[model samples]
Target: MARRPLVVIGSGLAGLTCAWASDPQGCILLTAGVLTDGAASMWAQGGIAAALSPDDSTALHAEDTWRAGAFAGDRAVIDRITGVAPEVVRLLVELEVPFDRAPDGSIDLALEGGHSRSRVAHAGDHSGAAVTTAMARAVRAAPHVEVREHHTVTRLLADASGAVCGVEVRRRDGSLEVIETDRVVLATGGMGGLWAHTTNPTTALGQGVALAARVGARTDDLHLVQFHPTALDVAADPMPLLTEALRGAGAKLVSDGARFVDELQPRDVVAAAVWEQLTEGRTVRLDARGINRVATRFPAVAELTAASGLDLTRDLLPVRPALHYSMGGVTVDDTGRSSVPGLWAVGEVSRTGLHGANRLASNSLLEAVVTGRAAAADAITWTGVWRGSVRPADPATVRTRTCTAAPAASRPLPLAQVRETLDSACGVLRDGPTLQAAVDCLEPHVGDDAAYVAWLIARSALAHPLSVGAHRRTDNVLPEGVSA
Candidate 1:
């Protein structure tokens, strides 16, 4: 019998990079929308963080990642991810990504929050788009890689022994189709959309978590959600993001025309400060006047501000903290190996411990590409030779568990209701009562993916009593020496 090919779902940087890196003979790329459309990867602005500058070193990059994560990141994992970053940058450049260059013709690097060195490579402010577009073009032209768009993987198919065997996808026509495969790579992005005020695309519904969880795969750190401190404060539903690079370019965070909070602290600190200001009824704005050619440098942010009748370079653009990145998800090992034998995960959907509790700015895109290649290189050789069932492994915490049952087929409640509960119970700030109330509100939606993910986040938030990283609990106070 002929061996089945590998199935990679949710084409963002992780999925696309995996496709390009995997043995073309064994890879099939599936995206929820047309290629490059639904992915949050393309919307990324800051750029990939790497230690390519003579003034920078991989040790320093790893140290920054760990410090930004509140020391919760795995030291070995941090070293591994940061170590390969320079090579990843070289790969992207070879793929024809138009990285901004300095006057001497070397890659231009920018300094973002939590970094001691100016080492983030970019193409203006749209680095993610520039990188992914080049990779997408390569995928389209590759003879061995099959690119299939307009297909959403709704569920993973497992055998009686709990080993993944295939995937059930929902086509654009609202029909279901199953493709059998021994290897399934999920690159389904993050859960920022679960909150009302988020910088992620609304389509990022945390499907990978629910899908992986339903099949006895353990998840880690579901509650550790990052809040970008500078989303455009407009009436938009999924708020537009004001990239961290703006602050790197010397934009200041101000309240009532006075500078408040260091503009380059880790995201959690800045977000909490912004939240405190909001509670005190103060307006927070990002003043980008010092940066020369701000509009020319950040065309995307410029366009978004112009749409709101504000000039990014001249106006004090009103800003607020919004859900940004998830530092937790389906747990995986160095090579993107989930506990389930036939299933793998990468990108924001996989908790590789590189981000720990809070991700370093621009490190997410770097993690995406590094983990993507690792998953592909390992998953390429699968021949469905599993002789034993794989058990769910979540080692971060002893209490980690899987989703009880497959997600309910019931249609979820209104988007507004889900977002409201999440924002109330699990946004930038939280307490036991509020988190419990959120859990109670969402507990009834047994089969709803959004409600299920929301409940999971709330319960995880409630479990971590002391404030740590992005999870701040008002009801539980930590010891004086404890660092958040």
Candidate 2:
């Protein structure tokens, strides 16, 4: 019998990188929509963080990450990931990612909030799009890899041994198909869509977390979500992001025609500051007129502003805090292996403890590439050493635990209600009563994936009462040694 191909779910940065690295060993890449369309990775405007400059070092990078994350992340993991970051950038350059170059023909770096040095390697402001597009191109040309667009994975099938043996996917035509494979990697991005105002695709409803949690994968820090301070306050359903790189390039966050908060502080701090302004009924705008050649330097942000009938140079772009990234997710080790056997997770779906209470700016892309490559390498090794035969379980059995088709009584609340519940309770500032109320509201809808993940975040937030990093609880008094 032919060897079953390893299956990778989601087609974001991590998924693409994993599929690209699998190469001759091969794997099946699955995406719910067209490749790169719905991915938060493509929406990323800030670049990947790396210590490539002469003034910077991995140790400094690790320190900045730790400080930005509020010292809640694993030091060892931070060190390892930051150590490998420079090498990762080198590899991306070789992949023809077309990163912006300096006058000296060196990779152009940008300064962002929470970084001690100019370490972000970007291709204009559309760094994520460029990098993801390059990787997608590589995956398409790989002879060994099979690309299956619109194959939405519904369930992870585990055998009697409690090991993932296959997955059940619903094709574009609504027909279910089963692929038998011992190794499965979930790179399904973050749960930003659970909030009403998010920069993520509305479809990113935390399906990866739900799938992993149901299969007994360890999840941690589910409540620690990072909000971006400068999502353009427009009338769009999902808000358009004004990249932090703009602020780095001399843009100021102003309200009442005066600068209020430091633009280069950590995201949590800046987001809170922005939130405070909005709460006080003061309009906050990002003034980027001072940034030289704004349109040429950041074409993506220019286009986003243009669509809203605003010019980057002439307008003070209205801004507000919006749900941006998740710091908490399914727990994984250095090689991106989950606690469950034959199961691995990468990207925002997998919490590798590099971002503790909050994520450092531009670190998500770095983590995505690192974990993706690591998972691919380990998956290849596992397939080589473990040649155990496995059969696909009944597709019906797999769908039994899925969120779809739940009985009316236990069905999930509408996405609007879910968003309203979370948005009211879980913003930049959270309190005990609001969090408890959110938990109570979402408890009954645990059968639904969105509700389940939202419940997890609310529960986690309520359980952690301290004001640490992004999971700030306004009702709690900080302990003697703890930083608020």
Q: Which ten residues in a row have the lowest lDDT in candidate 2?
A: 389-398
Q: How many residue pairs clash (N, CA or C atoms closer than 3 angstroms) in each of the candidate models, in the order given? A: 1, 0
* Per-residue alpha-carbon lDDT of candidate 2 for residues 1-484, written as tens digits (9 for 90 to 100): 7777899999999999999998678999999998976899998898999999999999999999999999989999999999999999999998899998989998999999999899999988889999999999988999978999999998888888777889999999999999999899999999999999999999889999888877777778888999999999999869999999888899999998999999999999999999999899999999999988999998999999999999998999999999999998888888888767788899999889999988999999999999999989989878434332222322321222544334541776999999999988998999999999998888767777788888888988888888899987888856568895
Q: Against the true structure, what is every candidate's RMSD?
A: 3.3, 4.3
Q: Compare the candidates by lDDT and give the number of the best one.
A: 2
- Give the runs in model 2 whose Cα sits over 4 Å from its true position: 383-409, 477-484
If scored against the real structure, what TM-score would every candidate get?
0.94, 0.93
- Compute the lDDT of residue 256 as modeled in candidate 1: 82
Candidate 1 global lDDT: 0.86
